[model samples]
Target chain A: MTGYIEKKHTFRSWVIEKLFMGKTIKEYLKGLITPFNFVAALILLVGVPVSVYRFTQGIGPSTNLSDNNPWGLWIGFDVLAGVALAAGGFVMGTAVYLFGLKEYHPTVRPAVLTGFLGYFFVVVGLCFDLGRPWRLPYPMFVSVGVTSVLLLVGWHVALYLATQFVEFCPALFEWLGLKNFRKWVIKLTVGATIFGAILSTLHQSALGALFLLTPGKLHPLWYSSFLPVFFLISAIVAGISMVIFESMLSHRVFGNRINHQGVDFDKLTLGLGKAAAIGLFAYFALKWVGVAHDNRWDLLNTPLGHWFLVEVFIFVFFPCLLFTWAVRKSNAALVRFASIITVIGIIINRINVAIVGLNWNLEDRYFPHWMEFAVTITIITVGVLTFRWIVNRMPVLYEHPEYKEIDQ
Target chain B: MEISRRKFLKSISAASGASLVSKSQFAHGAERFTGWPERFGILTDITRCVGCRSCEAACNEINKLPAPKIPFEDQSVFEKIRRTDAQIYTVVNRYPNPKPGGPAVYVKKQCMHCDEPACASACLVKAFKKTQEGPVIYNKDVCIGCRYCMTACPFYVPAYEYDEPFKPEVKKCTMCFERISKDGIPACVEACPMEAMTFGKRSDLIRVARKRVIEQPDIYIDHIYGEHEIGGTSWLYISGVPFEKIGFRMDLGTTPYAELTKGFLGAVPLVLILWPAFLIGVYMFTRRRQEMVETEAENFEIEEDQQ
Candidate 1:
């Protein structure tokens, strides 16, 4: 009887150890680093010095800012473009978890995690460009301008960050093998997911509304009263495209996880392709309407007008048509290419709005300094590192069928 | 369960249709209204300006702004057109020829003090305010040094104190709100040797501007520069030449600058209030159908096992 009791105790301990800690720290680190770390590290080495120079010497010293133009690549590419691209994770999270599309469950964890990290980096990028980042919270607590679009953006970004964190908590719970807590989190997922979706819609549009306040400063071709709506819709397209791009990237970089989970990349890609097509179609129609509403057809004859047409036709129109064709054909490769083009289109649109379109008549335009580029790169490196850290420990890309079976 | 699936599909279709309808309605609604009224403003008359630089001198003295590269008395300063900087709050620029053979034209460079002043609207913190007395003022104490207001300003009036290490703020024309409140003229207006920079109620300024344009049509542009530009600025201008030729933006249109974002801003509350309920309803509708189907499947399995 004594021997049997000892044996039973040892077996129980073994089960606990296996379930609670799937892999040792060393093993987890090895899995996390994957070849991607080297590329991220190389990018960081160049990015760190640039960021330091920006803080010490000021933005004017490092960037091409002038009295005629103030905003540059930092605001245009890193903050605006980066934020739009990250919209994918939230859009996917809403479709799968909130809408109870069980087929999309496998994509939810990674998508939300990506969304969370993407936004986190966007805030970091913004802080770097802000002349006084130390006083950032003044907008949140000390003085609130409820009427301003930026105030809405500031609040929404904060709230959405918290929402994304909650949305991603279940993955962490699963990684820890905390079945009871994980179950509780799963129950709240629907609420958190929906809340995130709502916040994403508001803030993404608010980013565009921030530009609307400068109607005279921005070029007539880009300026529109419907700027917020345009931004919100474009973000939807950007988000879907970003997910497709990231998924393809993950498939290449972390094939082990994809293989382990037996993820149906073909089906996932198809679904995303469909979403991209719909979003692009709507966005294209709106672009035309925006031009029409402003009656800016006369501008098309000028050089600046021609540039606007190029941005719309080559970047927006082409990619949108490509997305539709790729989705209908169920061609994953074609869809992936279209997704990349769509992301490029978003970048072009944002850059045009923030930089190219601003002070169009001025002979001098603001160009970003090397230091600004460095800081942008550094922030991106940090985002990549954070993503690696989360994916390493969390069950973000894997299924824990054992946990589900045990609960049953 | 089958019927519930159909109902869920129907609801989704209806909801999507509603979203489309609302989107079109939003587009129409935005185009209908011009912009908000009761906006702060300023007016400058180019024809009345005499290149005395008294407004520039007074602005520097009152704001405690730093001295300029060129002394106020140096008549040669008129040879080169200058812009406002962190140190200078205002400048008077001279156009060498007003009407090809006429005397030199002088236009003051300061904040336009737009009707829906974009700087005030853009500031995240309530640092910038559109005072009822037709001045857009900045509160440095509340500023976080974001410089978004600088970016948003159509006229690029606000300049950042980038050289300051610990504390920095946006510097711009405040329309002398403190003096105006005390029933005094703005320092610039008071110091103007030619009465070029007029100080009066916005309503009176418009009337004065119209009289000047109507009295001497050849000496002034028929259009008042700020009366309708960007929803009417506090400082109005009447130029002998086209305003565009004399460095004014002609494309600003009559709508208040801030009105551009009104449709989106107004929609924010509506979205905030409605989106959650709309999404939750969809969630519950989907979840309930899933549960009913699961329960039916479970009941069938149990009956089979019992048999």
Candidate 2:
């Protein structure tokens, strides 16, 4: 009886230690009252009800979507921009596991966690946009539209989310102190990485292919047969820049948890900047190639044409030059700054394609309703909170001492 | 000279049975589908229309839609050109006639129902289908209400019940599928006192449109509107004025919209096949290179220790 009691006591202590950061309930509650948490709570308080109201009220009342514009902010920012930013997982996974660049292995766990959460929230955002959210799995199980580009996107996103979870399983297991499970998951890493790459390549491009059927609806300057290629190459840029951008933020926010371990983080940032420069240049060339292929030179002087030029020149070309200069000068701060701009540029590009350039000739244009913004902000807040919670507890920023050698 | 009818029939059946058995699967590996051979179509003669809203009323009644705010006979509704909406599946818009001081041209607008439907290609859940009959029908039971069909449609035909929170559906012209399937003409066609619309097999409709255009060159344009637009639609049109002037887009090419995504979708399986093999190859190569470097470093360290 005494032995069983002692075991129960130890288990309780373990839970308090692991879950509460070795603090008493009162102490943990006090620690949670930080400025960040207060703001997050306030946002959620208002945002959560707005999302509920959306389910009760219907999309028309909550959003500016009309017959002319079916897709809006949820698809533009939440799904497209979210998916692009989350490309860091496949990028880092391929670098560490497939190409055997072990130095980048540290960023893999956080990247995968961010990616997994990002995709999870994308589905959540899609639920808000879909009229029947419960039937999301119908495409996979009930009726499959094999010829559709969206079916490819649906299947790939679902499969890739699972793959990312598997890839990040080691960190999760290590956090839980499950020795045997962590060992088994580590063995599956390379296989999962390869599968992630395959899935990522198809879905990222398939998102672009969704617009191919709207050649007449989308503006001539933005529409092209090479949309899929442009999307894929730019996604690669988004991935690399996102890794740099995320690491910069993570090192600042979670600085105490990360052990430097003599790793040259600045060197890694510059290396990523170099790859991003290459991707941006290729994307820039392809943008003009698309223009020339369509022979839409006359359109370059119109107002919408001017906007397209701004997107191509300021966003794509300028970022290419900035990344190149930053890499050549070995300026890590500049690289980080360039990454911030690149991330914003990717968001702009997605929004332009999904909203601005679509139905350009229409008289009634669509702008997101405030309720739509609230729902979007709510989703992002929840995602960030989830990311923070996992990062704080899991073996993401630092290696667990018990299995340090076994992790690799 | 003494051949019996039964002997001849037996030989003919033996020779043709193999081909007849495979006719249902005739679409397999065909270079292009020319739609269902005997599919029906509607050919509208624009000159014959007199801006009558009877067809609209008939469509509404047959579809069991909510009553319009303005009565069907109210001619004031033509002041503003309108589109199909959640409650309204078809609309009639009045455009300025090409000839100055002439009467306005009233065009009936609804779903074009392309031979290779863009909605069918865009739907992730296969909610929409091109039926063997003329109508491109929708199955609401399987619909997830993504509204991608609204975006994919060239004519901007499909509308969503945005007001219905729980049971939203994509609303569009069914071409009176229930009536057509039961061997009855559409309510709109039956309601038209002007006989402006003709319903028949798609091929016969094309022939009728061609004969009208050739017979009345001065009165009709030298084109059949939907005959070759986006790989031919079930709804054909013959107009006296230029199609562009009456709100029809002439820029839509003859290629089926489904062909646009074919290359990308085709590459999906190719990636699934090739990407893993390539990644594995690279993984093996990198692992071998790393192993070689470690061994070389170990050999050097051993020699130094001996020294």
Candidate 3:
């Protein structure tokens, strides 16, 4: 009995030290009562009950989706936009491991963690939109529809999620003090990154291909045969912009954790901005090419045509110009601003494709219910809380001192 | 009795062996599926259709759907157009006559049951199937309720049970599969007072529709609406007025919707095969370059030390 008690005592102290930062339970609870936590709690308090109401009730009451407009805000903002923004994982991985740009090695962990969390929450958000959420695995294990574009998406997301988890496992193993496991996972990094790039290329373009069947339904101005190419290029821009946007916020929130010696983050930001600028320019020229290809110039005088122009020129072209100026002038703050605009532009483009431009000729329009908005906000908050929790406990933003010499 | 039974079994085996040989001979040279040659279809004569709702009533009764708030006999339902829903599988809309002084034309709308169904191509779970019997059937048992079928259908035929909290299904016209599989006509066709719908083999129905248009060119339009639209729907139609002036959209081209996504799906395997090989090549080049740069820097430092 004494030996067992002593072992238990040692384990308890280790947990308190590692998980709680050597603070008592009371002090740890007190530390979590910040303004941000309080606001997040308030949002959850309203959002959770709303989510429960949605599951118990039917979709008709919870959302504004109809037969004419089957998809709504959940699919547009969560599944489509979420997957596009989460491209940072493969982007950063391929840049560092495959292309041998070792200067980007520091941003890899945070970017992959954000991507894993982003895709994880996208599936969570999809659960609310699916009529039979429990059968989500049916497409994979039960009956595979090989001809479907969605099947490609389903398989890629599942496989890529596993790949990303493997890529981020070194951080997790280091946090748990499993030195042997960390070494094994670090060795698998290049293979996992190559696999991740292949999966990302297929699925990101496949998401755009999902709309190819609806050329008659989607507005002519937005519909083009080059949709898959457009989507792939825009995803690269979104991935790079998200890295810049996320890094800006991470530095402000967790500044002390960064090892500032010899690592110039501002210079990295400028490099990413230059890449994003080039991507946006390509996307902009392609958008006009799409218009010319379809001969939709006559539509520019109409209401929806003007909206498309705003989406292209203001959101896409303006950001391209801003990013170009920022990179040339070496203005990190300006690059951050351009990234925010570009992020918003990606969101707009996705929503326009999935919801707004779809069924444009129809009489009835879909507007999401208040409860739907509540559910979306709740899912995002939970994701943020989980990210913060993991970043606090794991070696994500900083390297563990014991594993300092081991390069992943 | 034992001898007679053995002889019967021998004859049955002999017949089965002959059929198996013939089946292989027929399959020798065919590479592409030209669809079921003997599949049944319906010929819908729009001019003969009255505004009466007997077909709708019969469809609801045969499907055992919940009753509508407004009874089937009410004429006020024609004031606004209606579409197929969870409770109703078919609807008829009245359009103003194109000649200005004639009676209103009533058009019945339902699933076209195309030869190549877009829903079957779009379903990730293989929930939708295009059977050889000429009906695009849905298997709710495997559906994950993604609603992509609703998005893919060119005719907007599929509807969902959004009100059912659990076990919601995509509902559409089954083409009376239970009846038609047993060599019986669909409920709506049997219930038509004017015999507006004629049921026969798809090829025979097309021949009959062509004869009608060729015989009376002025009474019928020069074109059969569904004869070539979206890869030739099983439910063929012949109308007096232009199809576009009525509810039919002339803009949906003759190409099969499934063919639109074929290029993308075909590229998936190519990427799966080639992307890894190309990425590894890039990685090799990058590693070699990095090593060369490191050696160059080391040589420079050694020369500086000697100097």
Instruction: Give the number of the best model, judged by TM-score.
Output: 2
Between 1 and 2, whose DockQ is larger? 2
Candidate 1, what DockQ?
Answer: 0.40
Question: What TM-score would chain A of each candidate receive against the reference chain A?
Answer: 0.88, 0.98, 0.98
Give the least accurate 10-residue stretch of model 2 chain A, judged by summed lDDT. Answer: A399-408
lDDT assessment of candidate 2: 0.90
Query: In candidate 3, what are the lDDT values of residues A80-181, reduced to their tens digit?
Result: 999999999999999999999888888899999989999999999999999999999999999999889999998999899999999999999988889899
Tens-digit lDDT track of model 2 for B1-307: 8878999998889879967886786466757787988788999999999988899999999999999998999999999989999888888889999899988899999999889999998999898999999799999998998888888998899999887899999999998889889999988989999999998898999999899999999999899999899999999999999999999988889999999998888787789888988999999999999999999999999999999
Model 3 chain B worst lDDT run, 10 consecutive residues: B25-34
TM-score of chain B of each: 0.79, 0.92, 0.89
Of candidate 2 chain B, the 10-residue stretch with the lowest lDDT total is: B22-31
Writing each residue's lDDT as its tens digit, candidate 2 over A1-408 gives: 999999999998998888888888889899999999999999999998898888998988989999989999999899988898898899899999999889887878888888899899999999999999999999999999988889889999999999999988988888888989989988999999999999998899888888999999999898999988888888888988888988999999999989748789999999999989898999999999999999999999999999999899898889889989999999999999988888888899999999999998888799999999999999999998898888888889888888776646
Order by DockQ, highest first: 2, 3, 1
Q: What is the interface RMSD of each candidate, in Å?
A: 1.7, 0.7, 0.7
Off by over 4 Å in 1: A1-39, A177-180, A259-262, A405-408, B1-43, B73-80, B96-98, B295-307
Q: Candidate 3's residue-wise lDDT over B195-307, tens digit each?
A: 99999899999999999999998889988887788777888999999888788988888888888899999898899999999999999999999999999999999999999
